[model samples]
Target: MAQAKGNALGALGKLTELRQRIFFVIGALVVFRLGSFIPVPGVNPEAMTRLIQGGGGLLNMFNMFSGGSLQRFSVFALGVVPYISASIVVQMMGSVVPSLQALRKEGEAGRRTMTMYTRFGTVGLSAFQAFGIAAALQSQTAAGGAPVVYTPGFGFILASVVGLTAGSMFLMWLGEQITERGIGNGISLLIFAGIVAGLPGAVSNTLGMASNGELSVLRLIMVVGLVLAVTAFVVFMERAQRRITVNYARRSGGQRAYMNQTSHLPLKINMSGVIPPIFASSLLMFPATAVSWFGAGHQSRWLQGLTQAIAPGQPLYEIVYAVLVIVFAFFYTAIVFNSQETADNLKRSGALIPGIRPGRATGEYIDGVMTRLTGVGAIYLVLVCLVPTFMQNYWHVPFYFGGTSLLIIVVVVMDFTAQVQAHLVSHQYESLLKKANLRRN
Candidate 1:
């Protein structure tokens, strides 16, 4: 840890580009937070907060991911949710749609085309969600009977829809900018920032509960320790990999025949990264949020039952959430690393797995290995996701200290630090090459 800190410090002091990227990320996050505080037209932030808190369950989760923007009824209340939902839709389509699937092989042009599709989808989803939210807020009343939306009319709905959609679109663009000009995965970092933004209040709330005997000190300590332990375990698992040995065919040089070389392809234990949790959280939050709107005014029995059934601590919610995380884990891993494609590339490069044949057999062998790895990965995701539900239900831990938030925070931090170190290493290598060339000259 000390060595890592020292290296980070050295990089910051010596690497201009790394320093700039770090500063850029910090600045972008500041902008995100500032936007979170800016309320949309004709909506009462305090009233919205009261209504949201009363709704509880999924709304809290949504607010947490949005950095409290939802409770504030801010322009960014939607956050990058629409964008994430769009990504989920697009990725699922890419798996099924021949044209979208074909784009994956087109390289940079393919990526650009897919990104355009995602952005277009983001706009559409954002507008739909914003319109629903506007209509819902118009009907909502706080505990004291204050309207969440002060002016409930067509004008207000139009304004809210436009404001929220524009905010979502802006955030999508900002995230892309950060990804290009800054550090880390921009969308992941934005989510990380949202989670971290709520930490101070969560800590204070926990302390207040402890002081009031609402939470036992012993239990509080256990929660803290469990969180720390989970974080450490996640770090270990993220770095863990399965290495498969591959042998390269012998090559003929000018006057020498080089022997075959051996290498190992490292497959990450969690190839899906934080994506599965994020995807699951976003998907699960939607139904609850939608059900909530109907329950607010109508009080229908089925709607109420659904609201409770899918509540955060409920058995149904927990089961579905775990299943989604597990499914997305395997699904996303398959999307990210295609075994047949990898095998084909390897074959073209004259490499073969120890006992597997060069083409279809190699692909099958790799797919088998990946299937096992993904199973383990999916189980890990389920545990990490569900443990917090158990803790929040039984142990009374704050939802802010929940599993999804922690996984995202840990994974994003790991990825960001890894990128920073990689940048420093690249810079050093370039410096070394320059020095060697100068010496030769």
Candidate 2:
């Protein structure tokens, strides 16, 4: 009874802490969503609505990422995409640049410096993207022939560039604050929030389509069923891991000898998590986004052809996206989990892999295993991302059905749940320690 009571008390304490964190996250996201509705100066609200409703390729993707900010030509239209892009660039550079690689070895200080650099890069990228968007809006006309921007001039462009850039930076700051004070990764939570915010609208749109005969009931059922299946698959795969056994030699201290300790080094199947898909999506969207700036409504024959080829669900686009996801899966896995470093750390701790030598051979073996795992992981990501594309092409389902958005939603929810559980466990441990001390006293 005492133990059960202790457990209850511990859980209650942890629940209180978890509640605070959850509240902080909710408040931050509420702020973000509110900012998404504040339109940029000179943008015609009605025209913006029509353009968004029409849904061009790049514009749709941007709107999705921005939580519909781009649809309204809001100040936060650029979103945290630039920050994500900057992080990708900085991380990729660490693999190739000797200085960065050395700095990466310096621990927390180096991480702070790298974060500052990423912030600078985010500002620069946001400004560039904001300029492109401003220019594109100037040339863009809705389906009803109304211009998206009422006043297209240098003044409008300058205000947009400043406003959009400031909004993105503020969002970046909010994400950082969430990471420090809230639960889960702040940037990821921001993206997850944005994606999830559209769920209600997606469901409504699907129902409307079904009612209007644009979509059959069977097709809607299939889409919903597929989304549930994909989400389950993602959850299963994310939890899957390969455990490599490690043995630590017995140590002798004074007259007593410690027994050999056995443990396992767990390597997750998807070591790169959602990063590969996010990177691939960003890279694939870049060309289309850039083209939208110069060729909003009017495009040359070649430009038009290129745009079609790279548009979502296009054969060429799918192929490139899959390839990029695979490549980035390997690349990010290598960066995060270095087999040599792992082997070295184990060796230093007097541990060795079962039946493997404690040096180069162990590293090679671990690397080979990781390579195979990453290959499978990459294929899983590609399939998960492409399933929605296929559904959209054939069943004409919306983009949110089963792609990157679904993946992020599943992964983030799993991660957040895990964090909450961890906090609860810690609280329980602390309670047990206190009880033990009280008994001794």
Collision count for each candidate, in order:
0, 0
Angstrom error of the Cα, residue 210, model 1: value is 2.8
For candidate 1, the per-residue lDDT at 227 reads 81
Model 2: pairs clashing at backbone N, Cα or C within 3 Å:
none
In model 2, where is the ten-residue run with the lowest total lDDT? 292-301
Write the residue-wise lDDT of candidate 2 on 1-441 in tens digits.
986787688778778888999899999999999999998889899888877766565567668877889888888888898999899889889878999999898999999989999999999999998987787789888777788888889999999999999999999999999988998889889888887888898888878889999888897888778788888999999999999999988777877676688899999998988788877876776666556546545545576667678887778988998999999999899987889988999999999988899899999999999999999999999999999888888667765644778877888888888987887788778888888886799
lDDT of 1 by residue, 1-441 (tens): 764575566555668777788899999999999999888889887888888987765688778889999999888898888999898789878877999999977999998999999999999999998998888789888889888888899999999999999999989988998999998899988888887898898889989999999988899889888888888988998899999998987787877677788999899888987788877876777666666666545556666667677777777888888899889988888887889989999999999998788999999999999999999988998888788889878766764667778778888989999998888788777666655775699
Cα deviation of 212, candidate 1, in Å: 3.6
Candidate lDDT (C-alpha), each:
0.85, 0.85
Error of 1 at 425 (Å): 1.0
C-alpha TM-score for every candidate: 0.91, 0.91
Provide the clash count, candidate 1. 0
Pairs clashing within candidate 1: none
